[model samples]
Target: MIRPKLELADIFRAHGPAWRQANAGHVSLGQLKVMSAIEACRTETLGGHVAGCASCGHHHIAYNSCKNRHCPKCQGPAARDWMAARAEDLLPVEYFHVVVTLPAEIAQVAFWNKKAVYDLLFRASAETVMTIAADPRRMGAQVGMTSVLHTWGSALTHHPHIHMIVPGGGLSPDGTRWVPCRPGFFLHVRVLSRLFRRLFIEGLLALHRAGALSFFGDLAGLAEAGAFAAWLAPLRKSEWVVYAKPPFGGPEAVLAYLSRYTHRVAISNSRLVSADDATVAFRWKDYRIKRGDRQRIMRLATGEFIRRFLLHVLPDGFHRIRHYGLLASAGRKANIGKIRALLGQSPAIAPPEAGAEPVPLTLREPCPCCGGPMRVIEIFRRGQKPQSRAPPRDQAA
Candidate 1:
């Protein structure tokens, strides 16, 4: 993909210092680190290397990536790498895409209690699916799924939701048979929504009662038990949104979907139209529309754009992607083998032997001057420019 003319780095490099100073005490360490990482990515603030193509004597300087998960510029390669690793996990079965969303009232609370609340969101949603699938009336089998947490909508709003990819079937209770769901249907969305709402609310109440939740600003009154209960009163009756898309065409579609989502950031550079000293303009999709064009451009004050972007910097050490049931790290491989055998399929090839040196992944990025690899020749440290002179254009081999 071609790089965008504008980038998050451009905005950060221009406005981040001022924004940080203006919000000094209010900003978080994690957010500040994200800003710093993005601003310095592929710049002299980080070290770089010199790449040369011997075939044509083509040479150029290349900077390093921050590899920060929140960096929009970095997620492309991260997503590719993640998808490559997950490719082997796909099964020869239809996969369903399920979305579980937290309502607005609860989202406000999640703003202050990110780690605690999002943790509950992950567990409650996963448990709801696993529990429902395991019931004799539903599928009566153990299902496996991968759940990814997305905290931003197209307009960069803080909308926390889980996008789960689940196989349309599972291992039987006795672990002897593979049970598939009814064609074109996984589970009842209304039933999933109700159960998910109940489980999440129960978890939230436990957090509140155990004093694990904190209140601030307009929510300060919720510090008291009665006030907290009152705040949560209407949520119990309201309908939560949970929906499942029809099963994917096959494993190829599953891989394609995972590549787009697994390592996604709050926004991508392609969505950015332009930015100036005072304001920023970007494209967004208006999901409220059901049948018409949803493409729209939104302009926001420069400061507000940065604020919205920073709203999604997850808590340090908090995992945004998770696996559950058969996909859970523990026993995942073993479970897959069992399911394969039950399906009359052979077990997957063995992974590399213990302590064997793994093969390195070589990038096929070719230099523009000639169709050849750009081999790294010299390394430079941070805050330093390249000392070696570039090969003259006339010096082509």
Candidate 2:
């Protein structure tokens, strides 16, 4: 019997008329490729290639995987490998998680200028951290931080935010000593929030001046410079929602966090409860409540679920994971070396893991009458195949 997970895959495998209707005018090349890849994943559509069984002499025609980054089936291994590479970059110090969110008013703008707005979110958040940490009145040191962009809320709604995992301390400007933040506090959330709003608005204005942002449909009126400026005016006056939780209890806690938050898409397969007929059910966390007790399960029509998931596909080739301050990619190694020397901490080295390839999967057995594991046994490949089998299975028996 197919498990629910496999059932979900089966659903993804079919390019249902419903999916076509929902995405009729909205499909992009990337989405089309993703759907096609999922449909052809284990089927013969793309033309199956052979993978001979070492033991059974079975010439199994293994179908090829699409290997697209956005495919849910393919992202797990990709995320694992990426996390492994980043494991070596962990600092042996306390770290904090900070979230910078755009108000709904700005989210409308962000929806249209995702790449540009997201980039600004990263830059603005990083700058806020670095500036405050380096202030003599504050931490008085230079900090290293990593940021990841998340574009969706728990219910797969369009909510743009930046999540940053930052070391809780930094090196002094003179590079003479390590400076630690107040035990329970990093930067002032209110101050950071204000600055973030300013920086983001400034970047938005720049993009508008550069003719890079678009306003369409409901946002058509925002195309006017005065309208946009007026729209941004209120956000600057109100709190911009910079949230900071306490530092991760330790370095290990930080790693556990990155594993959960970074590289995550709008939803994970495990969250899916079921997909039957034309409805899909899934679980999500309602973060508005206290942290540990906020999970909820919800259901949506299959078309709506797919639409929500695809809303976060991201602009092509956009980098969602970003490094800032000392962790910035340009000179991260050298900076890490400098910081390690100052803090008297050695460079991080990932512990060795028992490297092993996973066992390949195969069907339990061939249909009893067919004997042994199923195989193409013979190939009339594609158009060359005989019009029909000599006899159907029931008739053959």
Candidate 3:
């Protein structure tokens, strides 16, 4: 039976042609291909081969997955794997959540230069935090943080913001001790906003000077350096928003938050309710409200849904996930080692866990109740339906 919370895969399986018609001119050819690939995931479109248990004379057919990061059907495993790698980075200190948002004036340029601007957003924000925290007059410590880029608002609109989960403390630059922030406070938002604005404008100017930004239609005038500089002039005087919320529930909550934000796209498939009659309904969270007041339901035309989702289509091969400061890629291993030494803890490593690796089909059949290994007793080939079997005890007996 079809359900309201069905995913894109289920939606397309139910109404592929109608969705295609609605999105024909709105979505990019590549996006359409992604949609098609998602539609065909775990189906016969990609073809499959049968596997059999020779001893038990049992078999089943397995289908192929699209594996596109944007495809809803594939993000689950991807998120899980990402979380597994990051789980060890958690520090034993209080963590804070800060969000730095872009002003409407820059949103236009950001839309065209997502990779560049977003990269700058991360850099500028990280630098702002480190600069403020390390000042002798301020927190005066090297602070470590993990930042996630969120490019959408609650309504699926393009409102770029970076959500950072930062530890309450950091290693002293000399790597001798961990310095913690004052209780209930991290860094000065006013100072952070100023630095963030300056850094971001500089990065944008660099991109513009290098001819890396694309302008079209109404924005064509911005192609000139004078016009671009003039546009940025007011932004310098205007304040950028750098908001810091209260400390999270220690390190655990911080990791939980990171696990959600780092992998988020414009929307998740689970939020989807239905796709029919050229409209799609879904759920969203309104972060501006009190607790228990955040969830809301919304609907949009199929074309608009596709448009919003595609708005977040990153430049190909751009690394959405990144590390900076202590987590910077170049010397992360050594840096982490040095940090652990200062904290009086060993360099972090993954601990063994059951089922950490993929479980094979053969390992799945040792029955817990019967203490016996079971094997597939029959083959279910492609295009061949499984025959009806004996009913459960309640119905058969």
Best candidate, TM-score: 1
Task: Give each model's whole-structure lDDT.
Answer: 0.88, 0.73, 0.73
Q: In angstroms, what RMSD does candidate 2 have relative to the true structure?
A: 6.6
Lowest-scoring 10 consecutive residues by lDDT in candidate 1?
A: 357-366
lDDT of candidate 1? 0.88
Candidate 3 lDDT over residue span 1-397, tens digit each = 1122477777655666666675567556766776678787766566544434434433344445678777766666677778877777766667888889999879888887787888888888889888888887887777767777778887889998888877787777677888888988888889889989998899889989999898877888999999989989999999899999999887567766776777776777778877775788889887878788788888987767766876777667777666767777776667667766777776687667776753344424333234344343433444554343422211221
Q: Which stretches of model 3 miss by more than 4 angstroms? A: 1-4, 12-26, 47-62, 286-292, 346-397
Q: What is the lDDT of residue 118 in candidate 3?
A: 83
**Clash number for model 2?**
0
Look at candidate 2 and give me any clashing residue pairs: none
- Residue pairs with backbone overlap in model 1: none
TM-score of each: 0.94, 0.80, 0.81
Please list the residue runs of candidate 2 whose C-alpha ends up more than 4 Å from where it truly belongs after superposition: 1-8, 15-17, 41-64, 288-293, 349-397
Best by lDDT: 1
